[model samples]
Target chain A: MAITSDLRNVPLIGQAIQRLCSLAALSDIESHQIALCVVEAVNNAIVHAYDREAQHEVQVIFAQYSDRLIVQICDAGHAMDPKHLAPQTASPLDFDPCCLERIPERGLGLAIIRTTMDEVAYTTSHGKNILTLTRFLKSCQPGSARPEE
Target chain B: MQLDQRKAGDALIVTPLEDRLDARVATDFKERMIELIASGNTIIVLDLSKVEFIDSSGLGAIVSSLKRMGGRGELVVCGLRETTMTLFKLTRMDRVFQVFDSEQQAVSALSGNKG
Candidate 1:
């Protein structure tokens, strides 16, 4: 499914994720997680990928393998640096309850995507930034990565 | 992003009419919530029974709504599905807001009518 870079069309991603995950025999919970991750990717693409005036399009492709379901979100807006996706490490000594009070409500999109999807990979080629998220059908383990077949 | 609001024992019960609250309407949701706060109803109970899915933007909007309340009143959330609850827990927003199981419980807790 392809959608313009608008948040109003985000529901299509959920519908696609649900339909594809259902066909893959995923449980309701698993389906929901996949849908959430896809929604996050689409939202990121719509908000950050395109210029403020350009009407770029975002592409979502659903592929189901024997053991996993792969959803790829491709956008031509802006390429994302892989370094920003790396997990941040901070010292525990810097932690303060007051800091918790100041935690911004946003920026959890990437964390949610990483926590829900089994394997997440990003690549840019031919002026398109592709984010591939894979959810294993059989594994409930966190941070589990299966070699893509 | 329509919200159904009603008065219940000094607390305002606000329910979103949409099934999913995501980036599409997070800004509108925040605006309505702030409007509610401006109307002098500080104790608000958000009934999310109809909200099946909430993304980070939606969650952020709700957080900002809470912050808008500014310690004057309470913003209690109830009727969270397991998946939505997981999002709250994952983001640790569950600790920031007071969450209840049912709208009645939340209204009662905020209204000082625990019975």
Candidate 2:
């Protein structure tokens, strides 16, 4: 479903995320992480996806499978050029530290979302920018430690 | 959602900030406080009575604003809701900030303190 960019929309998004997380039976930390990711993603769609002069709706889809929780945030503003959305990387030692401090708040939203979710993907199709985030429900179990690569 | 501001002596008393102080509204909050500080109003009281939530970004913004005010001024927060207070405690920011139970209390505490 789609919602306007009002603050009230946050609770609806939270509810939707909670339902999916419960269905996946995620741990408290996992659910909290997913909720944080959803909040940042939705906020970005509301503030950055559309130009202020125009009205736009953000579409959210929650899909739960046997092993994963999938969330898709789609906006029909200007299609995001995938190349322009590179993940933020740590500064190299040679780079000026002051430059990092001056970076605008917009860049941190995507980084926070990526760091909180297990899997993240972005694509643009037919003038729609779809950002998908996935959390593998199974990997979080106590005994299911990381397998040898 | 609710905001209250008043003046006690030379200090500005801001109280009962309701709603989540999250990334969505941190900028506006920071700007308002910073503007007040820049207007030569140093002693400030932030009454977070109704605030129910705050995240890391929100906490960071508040700390950054406090730093901006420098050692010459004081920024004190009061009446933090239980959940909001928990965040401060977890981040150990409660140690860094002087918190009070009411605006009057904060004003009284910082009244004599000056740079």
Candidate 3:
């Protein structure tokens, strides 16, 4: 799916992703997690890469494997900082729960993607930044979306 | 984003009428929340019953509202969908906000604190 980098168009992408995840027989919660991760990836691309400019193009590619699901968000805008693709150890969620001031109000998109997906990778080539998110299937239903046992 | 706000004793309940709370409305939501807090609403019960999806941006708005309170008041949550609850748990916000099963319970809890 391709979008015009408008933040308002993001929720539809999440719904589409959830529907595709359903084809793989993912649980509602798992699907929600994957969809959210993809949404965050796209949001980051739009907000950071394109600077939230609505005219820019942001494309999302979804592929299902026998044991995992892969999503790739491709954008021709500015290349994202590779550090965001790295597995984050320190999280915004780690702050003191008692101190409201200590809690972070932003910078959680990367952490959510890192925690939900099994692996996240980033590569930039030919002016396109591709962020790949992978989530291994827990148990694929024996059907068209996966290999039958 | 439309919010249904009402008062119950000393607590103010704010419910987002929209099903999804993503980046599109996070800023607006945060602004509205800050305005409400500035208007001297001490205890806020964010009723998310109508909201089905909440991304980091939306969650951040709520956390920002809590910070706006600045320890001078209270902020709580209620009526979280299962997936929404997962997001809270993933972010460890479940530890930060007192969550109740119903709006009544949340209001009661806040009232109890005041009493």
Candidate 4:
């Protein structure tokens, strides 16, 4: 589904994330992480991509299979330079001083999304920036080594 | 969405913040803080146990509210979830505001202040 760049769209995106987590029957921590990722992604699209241009739309696609949940956020705004962004290493389960000191506002969203999901990839093509996040629901259990899919 | 207010002796307790404190709700949050300060509620404890997440705009709103309250009032935050706490630490807001692990601790600290 797609949503326009209205502030009202935030709750809708949040609700969608909740539904996805519910369907996956994720653990409490996992659910919260997913919710944060979804919110950050949608917020970035609205604040940076659309720049409050209500005429633009942020496209969200959710595809679920038996083992995985896939989410795609697509926008036609300016392509993002990933090199300037730093990855967030703060585990939701642990509080690290290094992670806490990095006060990154622009790149933290992408980093959190990357760390929480099983697989994260981004590409800019056709005047669009597409970010795809994949989570293997079955492999996310604690202490499980997720094999390459 | 609903804000519950009460007096814990000399300190005021505000609880159960609802809605995302982003650009949309920052204005309302600021207005409520200002109203509380104007009503002679000085030492304030904001129970943010219910706030799920906060953004930069929301962070700015809180800082602005603290400035508006001035030196007469103290704003202590309590019960921040991990995600919200991360935002605070990231912005160095943890240094700016005193944070407590529980509402009781926050209220007690405010009431115990000799100053």
Candidate 5:
């Protein structure tokens, strides 16, 4: 399913993500996490990839396998460097709330996507910025805490 | 997004009458908070008992509102669900803002501190 790069249409995408994950037999918590990750991905495409330009289209595709689910968000916008998609080295444990100079205001969308999804891959193909997020259903038990290790 | 605003002792308690605080309503929430703060309601307690889901944008807005308050004002939140609490913890925002279990408890804590 494809959606415009508009924040207003995000709820509809979220609803579709939830329904698709649920149909794949994922638990409520698992479905919710996946949906949130998708939202982050879509938001990033709109804000970063397309620069919040109007008339741009963001395509979303959901594929469910026996053991995993894959969600791909594609946008025909500015290319994102693959190196930038790597997770940041900064751990939340190292974050100091009082250190106003060090606190990061932006990039939480990428952080949330990286933290929630099992595997996140980003690339630009044929002038399309593609972000693929995969979740292994069997490996991650429903309602289980985040794998800190 | 309707905000239920009322006075509790010396502080203002504002609750969002919505189930999810995501990208759609984040800006509205932040704007409303700024308006309240501008109206001299510095000591504020945000009641989130009815909110079940909050995205990063919503969290960012709340943090922005806190920054807007600066040192002269206080912005405390209460009645967060486990998922919402987890977001704050993961983002290390739990240390930035004081969170309570109940609205009354938050009001008393802030009121007591002021008194």
Candidate 6:
């Protein structure tokens, strides 16, 4: 699924990912969580990689196997700094929840992805960047999930 | 980005009409809350009963609203879906704001605090 670097289209992409996750026999919570990870990755591509420029392209490719799901978000905008690829440990989640001022308002996207997805990898070459997320399916069976075309 | 609002004494109960309150409408949600607060609707009961999905951006917007309120007002959450609640717990935000099961309970808590 390809969408312009726009926030308005994120929910639609999330819904589609949720449906696909369900088809792979994931539970409702798992479906929602995985969908969220994909959404976060896509948001990174749009907001960071493309600098929120709607004219740029962000491509999301979903591949499901017997035991796992892999999603690759590709962008042609500015390559993300390698340090930002991995989620930060010092995030709003690490702070005392009661201390409102201690909690940061933003930068929760990548942290949520790291918390939810089993594996996260990013690669860039020749002005293109790709973020790959993989989640192993606990209840996956042969033929349950369709292979990528 | 429709919000169903009703006044329960000094508290305002705001329910998001949409099922998904992700990045798409998070900013708008925050701005609406700010608008209400600036207009003297201080004690807010954010009813999340209709929100089936919420992302990090949505969570950030909720936090921003709380920050906007500062110490002058209250921002309590109610009707968190199981999925959204899980996200709250993951971020430990469940401890920051008081959470209730329903709008009535939230309103009751606010009323009790005011008294």
Candidate with top lDDT is: 3
Candidate 3 residue-wise lDDT at B49: 95
Candidate 2 achieves a global lDDT of 0.66
Task: Pull out the clashing pairs in model 4.
Answer: B1-B18
Stretches of candidate 3 above 4 Å error?
A: A140-149
Give me the chain B TM-score of candidate 3: 0.98
Task: Quote the positional error of residue A1 for candidate 5 in Å.
Answer: 1.1
Looking at candidate 2 chain B, the ten consecutive residues that score lowest on lDDT are B83-92
Pick the winner on DockQ between candidates 1 and 2.
1
TM-score of each: 0.87, 0.65, 0.95, 0.68, 0.86, 0.92
Better model by lDDT: candidate 3 vs candidate 5: 3
Query: lDDT of all the models against the reference?
Result: 0.81, 0.66, 0.88, 0.71, 0.81, 0.85
Lowest lDDT sum, 10 consecutive residues, model 3 chain A, at A140-149
Q: Each candidate's DockQ score against the native complex?
A: 0.54, 0.17, 0.87, 0.23, 0.47, 0.70
Q: Quick one: best TM-score, which candidate? A: 3
- Residue A101 local lDDT, model 2: 40
lDDT per residue (tens digit) for residues A98-117 in model 4? 34333232345565566567
Off by over 4 Å in 1: A52-54, A89-100, A139-149, B113-115
Residues B1-115, model 4: lDDT tens digits: 4678998888888875584676567677878888888988888888888887675556666777777776667888998988788767655568667999999998777767844
The full ranking of all candidates by DockQ, starting with the best, is 3, 6, 1, 5, 4, 2
Q: What tens-digit string does per-residue lDDT give for candidate 2 at A74-104?
A: 8877665564446554422122323424323
- Residue A101, candidate 1: Cα error in Å is 3.8
Weakest ten-residue segment in model 6 chain A by summed lDDT? A84-93
Retained native contacts per candidate, as fractions? 0.60, 0.00, 0.84, 0.02, 0.28, 0.60
Q: Top DockQ: which candidate number?
A: 3
What is the per-residue lDDT of model 6 for residues B1-115, given as tens digits with 9 covering 90 to 100? 8999999898999999999887878889989988988898789999999998888889999999998888688999999989999888877788888999999999998899889
Candidate 1: Cα lDDT at A117: 84
Q: Model 3, A1-149: lDDT tens per residue?
A: 88889998888789999989887789889999999999999899989999999988889889888778889999999998787555554766678887767887889998888888998899999999999898988775443443211
